[model samples]
Target: MRWVFLVLIVLNALYFVWEQQQPSVHVQQLPSVLNPAGVANIEVANATNSQTKTLDSVQAKINLTLLLGGFSDPALIDSLSQRLLSLDIDVKEVVVEEVDGVDYWVYMPPLVSRSVAVRQLKELKARQIQAYLINQGDMQNGISLSMLDTMDMAKDLVQKLANLGYTAEIKEVERKQKTYWLAVNSRSERLIDESLMTELTSDFPLMRYRQEMPQ
Candidate 1:
């Protein structure tokens, strides 16, 4: 019985040795294009690139709006409108803005009426005072000293009148206004009116052209 038990133990030990000698089972790992986070990052990068390209395209494109000269002359503006129409440009309306300015006058006191103003101008001319009648507006009758920009020039004219033994007051006339600009937005930038603009520039020597964003 002891021999039998010894034989059984020897067999179990041999079986354990055989099991240890056997090859380990290997798991087959499939190749993947991207991991979970890697896949998300790649998708995000692709989306960002597409959005950037779209924004670049929009930024590169242009929609033009033009601003032209500001003129005080109605006749000149009317002429410009007609000329622009001739060029097939859809001209916008004239933007009339009244600016405060001084119209210096070399007239005697109490320029009560238009006749008085005219008579005053004549009297000043008779004295050889180089002056003209301010016509068409508020100072219509007053003898125009000079349409000077600075007060120094106006004072100089007043001094000259004083030399001629006459008093001329510098009137702060706010009625006289200036500048007419043509603002237009081209419906399509692909068809730019370069020739028309050139023609306009040629016509008005003082005309200013400015390009801005679409209105």
Candidate 2:
């Protein structure tokens, strides 16, 4: 009876080994740990990475201020700002500053003879163009076509004079000048160029970014 029990035990062991080695006997796959706890940890890690990227992007952006110059009149500054605003620069970003500086003027040719000057004034009157007579001192024979409050006005006046068969030009002088400034907050300094602000102010050759434009 003991021998028979031993033989049966050996047979059971052999059967178990054969089953494990058989190609058809596949191992059962276990379920993955995708419970609320695991998902929560994944979400936390994603959130952390997103926050880090935001901080790095913020740090990369810089704030700069540009000072637009070459304007002696507030009208010119206003015009420039309006043009910039049309180019998508916010109106709030533009500001006018009054500072001590020199101004320019547009003047017609000085008549060599007083009689010719008077006759020219009469012609201008007939054409409905209002002009000032330089009725004093060495410039007495000169005709003041326009007093420049802005370069645009000066140019326009000159063009008007040209249309009327009169030659005109701008004259540089001295007085208080108005300046325009633009404050920019951007991811790149190149954004200013991309915004087309530079092209708009190109006529104002002196326009530039100030060392202390932050104020």
- lDDT by residue (76-154, candidate 1, tens digit) is 7778777766756666754646566665544444467878777777877788767776665655555665666667878
- Model 1, which residues run further than 4 Å from truth? 1-61, 72-74, 94-179, 188-193
Candidate 1 residue pairs in clash (backbone atoms < 3 Å): 69-181, 70-179, 70-180, 71-179, 71-180
Error of 1 at 125 (Å): 32
What tens-digit string does per-residue lDDT give for candidate 2 at 155-207? 88888889889987798765654455555434233445744655765665656
Superposed Cα deviation of residue 214, candidate 1 (Å): 3.7
RMSD of each: 12.6, 18.6
lDDT of each: 0.69, 0.68
Local error of candidate 2 at 44, Å? 68
